[model samples]
Target: MILHLPAQKIPIQEIPIDKKVKLFIKREDLIHPEISGNKYWKLFFNINTYLAGNPEKPYIITFGGAFSNHIAAVSAVGNLAGISTLGMIRGEELKGKWRENPTLVFARRNGMNLQFVNREEYRHKEKLTEFLQSEFPDALIVPEGGTNKEAVEGIKMMLNDETKDFDYLCTAVGTGGTISGISEFCEENQKVIGFKAVMDNSLEETINKLTSKRNFSLIDSSFGGYGKIKDENIRFINDFKMNYGIPLEPIYTGKMMQKVFGMIEEGYFPENSKVLCFHTGGLQGIEGANLLLEKQNRNLII
Candidate 1:
């Protein structure tokens, strides 16, 4: 798969926590520039199993929003793996203009058949699943955000032997698959803190149902929910890049880092605690988001 990554640690310098506390990022974003971050791990096994179990079933289908990193990753990987991919995009208005959004444009370039639907219809993934089953029955359907048992199983690889001892593991939550997978494997002494990019509590139930471990908690850093950004979030993303030289997209990692800083200011962690964060990449979405921001007359996430 084009999604392969080796375990590597990168430090987060000058985190506001006391001198005793140390923070580092797992740097999953650096794995592959395109098929980067948690999406790569989330899709690695799903694609493999689909091909191995049903060789004749050459098609795979999945769901995503307008600028979803999951859609981008799946499309990029499918092209590499010789699989026909279909994307059930979330807005009917996006149907005709592929040039408007960078993510949609990339997916189309990679040979993905983009099917756009109304927001009301896209809310229920089961409806999309039913449609896929009826129209293309043999297609392997990966859930939105790639959060499925197979994706969770693949994500377990992100925490290997070297990263077993940290006191805490931090990551941004989208569909909750990445954190759920890490929660299962993180040792009893280590806790996982997931900062939700979306502002709903629905993901909590889904995550609880997926993993057996009680080692994780979700924190709100949505900045008014998924894909919607406010002034503070924009300032934080830009300042963070200027300070640390790491680019974070508004959808996920940016909110997560913001939450981490907020918690540290509140003295959330004990002195001498060790934390490692998984950088779930969505840097590709920046271009598309900036376009929307420009229209809103909001500050671009430069």
Candidate 2:
């Protein structure tokens, strides 16, 4: 199914976090069902490129965590496209059972084959290309998060039109593929900034390796770590919803907006400087985050 999302022009609103700066959101979160936001463009490119080769392969294989949106998208899209999908998950099976997490459940329901691996093996995912090739010789190997050359190229098409001159083009950085692709396409006049969702310095190196350009800036914006959401972040998420009617997940876009607000408060952005932020989709994960927060609140009350 072709992912269809309303590409409505998201308003450029003045920051309530600070009055001097302005923020514009690219509502990619509302892109589509299953293949939503960047995931759609990311996978769209990869699948097209794979078909370009005209290989005899009938399936695609990728890696991700238990609750990974990439896995979910791949499974959903692959099923609809009549292509098989294999998910190499990073973590042990749930205690006493193989099934665990909503993403995995949905992936299985969508007919994706799942294989769990240890943390160490998962960390060496890049090095396991040979192993993966040997296992699925006829399958195309997509990098985790679908962050690859084709994925980057597909996403760049969204930024082709100049709606307005932006001082900084920002987005949440995960595997650095999205930012790297954006940075590569950015002209000398525009600065590309990425907010790290995970609390790891290695992201800089990862991005550097992805692209040779120094025009990209990486900020350590993770409140604690990946999937680590604090009360302040929850408040920000709520405030964003109340003020702009935008639902931002704490793991990615919420942290990015949090940093943007911080930069505004610190007078990092000049007065009236336009900032375009990309809302990479993963809204489904919000349910998991809310459930965890509810349990935390309940424990505190007890």
Candidate 3:
């Protein structure tokens, strides 16, 4: 199952902000309908490398939350490649209630099997991964957010001659793969800023180990912890979409962008600096996010 990346260059559009720093966004979200953005590139080498070996049974096993974009993307890869997929979903309470979740529903429609596990078990994923690998030797078991060495290698494709023109490259850091790749392959003069979506304290060390150079810095962008969306976040997402004609999901992109804007307002960036942020796509999770927001009687992302 050879998945060919789209031949066209992803567009980088300038965000006309009144701030002194010039802001632009690389539309990685426009890469594909299902496997869009960094997810596509992160899985590029992973799935392709696994398929190159030509295992007798091509199966993919991965882990994620109920609304995890990684799970959705992996399921899409399985669907596209005609391979079987198993999703180790966190929260055993969601076992009988998976139908209520959009991401899980999409994975099911893509022919992916869902396995519900308790939080304790999910917390110790290394043990679970070992067991699963022993059980299914032929399966390609991707990490929680596809943040392995191969994934970093795949993320290198996100940078190019066009991206090199920027003084600072930015992205929403989930499992550190995207930022690590940018830090690894970016030019010496360019700095990389990672807007961390999760408050993982060990993320800096993890990302540092992934890249040889120390050209990246991480800032907390978790408005109210991971996956806990705030009213301000929804408002920012809605307003940004209305103003820019670009959609951003609540978890990663929205938070990252909101923080970036805040930093600009605080004069965190120097005057005349060119900043480019990668739109690491996870738009599929927006449906589930909106469903939760609707239940809470709040404004939905448009």
Candidate 4:
């Protein structure tokens, strides 16, 4: 039951943007087909540290929304490690409709047991986590989005000598763990920028507590809302793929890249500043996103 997968040296490629600022992207998405990008790093120490304890009957339990990348990654880890997994999914209505969702279907195929809880119950995750810990004492219950101290520690692997040359480190912020890691471990002169995918008001404070240094800034990148893909977003994603030959999931990477482009255009970055954005992968959500677009007779992401 070895859970420690070797982390890869993900390539940093230049994004050909006609701006004074040199824009680059870290291809973290290419790390794994299933456990891609930041999710892989976030779960790295969480799973390995738990497995190192050598608990008998190892089981993993985690929480996520229907199309959550975290849920998909955790299920993949469970399958790879030969550990049983339980997913406490938000929106109890999905219980009857889980088969329709590509992410949920993938989790099911990976042998993850799905348990749906209502929105209210999901919002109060602390109580649910407490109960689940009691029920499955041996289970490693990862927090929603796998954000924890261990996750922050794992994200350090994303940064190295190749990354230190950049003046700014950028990434799409979901649970704040990824940016927290960058802020905590980044070079003293480097500034961290987090493109917020979800409009969580408490996110700044949450990130502050996660890191001792205050070297990061958050930008509103939620073009419409979390998981609500607009026509413009779809168009941008298609154009980006066509031009850059890089696939970005609409929920996180797509929105972040869009906002980053806007910032570049608006002269948000200083001249000659080297900005690097982490392409945190969640490409698995594309199928489900395209399905929703097809139903609405909207433009699908390429």
Candidate 5:
């Protein structure tokens, strides 16, 4: 069963930070229930292509962190498609307490076989074939973040028939797969700016090796690091809701928008430059963020 979701071109709204500047959002967040945002497109075509070519392969295995949306999405979609899925999760054993992590809970409920691996082995996920061969020995291995060449090609379909005349195209960078794919499809005159959610130099090298586009630049705008948010980011999250009536989670889209606003204030973006921001969905994180906000409110009350 192929899931279909219409791409929404969210209206360009003028920023209160700068009245002269306009920001447009490509709402990939509203894509689908299981296949949300670019995650759907990234994994969908790759899985379909693999299955079609190799009908003998009955199971697919992938790797991710405990709270990874990719794992959750893959588990749900794979179950629906009648494919047995395995999730190699990074961390110590949490056999009985997996429900504490929402993504892990969902993945388990969707029939994903979970295996725990330490951080040391998880870092060497690129050589997953050896690990899987020693372990499952039969399942097809998918790279962490679903960032293979097939995944990049699948994500490129999201830009089909859209106007590519924008000055800047911005996206939240997780594994640099989506940005690298977008960079490949963008025109030479267009600039692709990626907001790195994690503080690391390796991601830049990864993207550089993936695409040969000189117009692409990855910014280290991570508010501290991956899954880490400061007070300033919380304020930006609040202001984003107030100004645009759109709620951005701190982990992904919030940081992207925060950096975009900061660049606008710093006068880094050229005047009257059309900016297109991609909203990579992570709505599951909202529960944790809201709980933190409530704790802060209670502290102020006390």
Candidate 6:
């Protein structure tokens, strides 16, 4: 079975902003309904490259937190490629009751084996790799968030002739693979701006490790941190959907868009400067995030 092709570039469109910075969203979100956006790019090469040269058929095993978009994407790819998928989930509390976790439930339905680990145990990747190698000897281990060299290769194609005219390349930074990939393909004059979806002081160096180019800068737009949201962000997301008809998940695209609008308002960009915003989809997590928001009596995303 063939995995969907990379470089599924969506039509570019301009959004009217007060500063007239010419902000255009390159809709990577529309690449696929389930395995949408950057996740698709991140997993594309990892699966293909591994399957190409391996003599022994192997199950795919990867890591992710409870609400991980990576887990869902890998599961879908495994189903498409006729490979068995195993997810080493972060929270041990979610072991048997996978159905209670929306993302895990979807993963299970897609035919992924669920293995839960405590937060402490999850931190040690080397140990996790050793353990998996011993148990699932035939497992092709895809790194957390699939940010390996092969994954970056697929992501580089996200920018091509159609997206070459933009002055800046922008996307939400997760494991830094997407932005890293984009930076490598960007022109010298084109600046790559990555807005962090999670707040971590160590992220700048983390992103640097994966990419050789120094043309990119990482900004903290993480509301508070990953999964944390402000009321204004929620309001902006709802209004954006009403105005543009493009939905954004609270975790990633929402925070990045909020930062972009703020930059425009503050004149961070020069007048008439063109910006390309990568719509890396995490819309699936909205349903689960909204559930938590409702229980906390916080303002919900539309």
* TM-score against native, each model: 0.93, 0.89, 0.98, 0.98, 0.89, 0.95
Encode model 6's per-residue lDDT on 1-302: one tens digit a residue.
24567454476777766567889998888888788888887877777777876738668999999899999888888887778999999989888777777888889989998989998999998799998889878778988988888878889757878788988889998888998899887888999999998877787787788788999988898887787778888998998998888898888998899899899888888878999999998788988888778988998878
Model 3 per-residue lDDT tens digits across residues 1-302: 45686789899998888778999999999998999899988899999999999989989999999999999999999999999999999999999999999999999999999999999999999999999999999999999998899999999999999999999999999899999999999999999999999999999999989999999999999886998899999999999998899999999999999999998999999999999999999999999999999999998989
lDDT of 5 at 91: 87
Q: After the best TM-score superposition of candidate 1, give how far the Cα of residue 47 lies from its true spot, in angstroms.
A: 0.4
State the lDDT at 69 in candidate 6: 92
lDDT of each: 0.84, 0.78, 0.93, 0.93, 0.77, 0.85
What order do candidates take by lDDT, descending?
3, 4, 6, 1, 2, 5
* Model 5 per-residue lDDT tens digits across residues 187-248: 77888899999988898888887777767888988877898767778787887787777767
Model 6 gets an lDDT of 0.85
How well does candidate 6 match the true structure in TM-score terms? Answer: 0.95
Task: Judge candidate 1 at residue 99 and give its lDDT.
Answer: 80
Candidate 6 lDDT score at position 116: 93
Q: List the residue pairs that clash in candidate 3.
A: none
Cα error, residue 105 of model 2, in Å, equals 1.4
Candidate 2 lDDT by residue in tens digits, 204-229: 88777777778888898888888887
How many Å off is the CA of 237 in candidate 5?
1.8
The Cα error of candidate 3 at residue 26, in Å, is 0.4
The pairs that clash in candidate 1 are none
Where is model 2 more than 4 Å wrong at Cα?
A: 1-18, 95-100, 298-302
Ranking by TM-score: 3, 4, 6, 1, 2, 5
Best by lDDT: 3
| Candidate 2 vs. true structure, TM-score | 0.89
Compared with the true structure, what per-residue lDDT tens digits does model 4 show for residues 1-302? 24355556689999998789999999999988899999998998889889989989799999999999999999999999888999999999998999999999999999999999999999999999999999989999999999999999989989999999999999999889999999999999999999999989899999998999899999988886788898889999999999999999999999999999998999999999999999999999999999999999988888
Clashing pairs in 6: none
List candidate 4 stretches off by more than 4 Å.
1-8
Runs off by more than 4 Å, candidate 5: 1-18, 133-138, 288-302
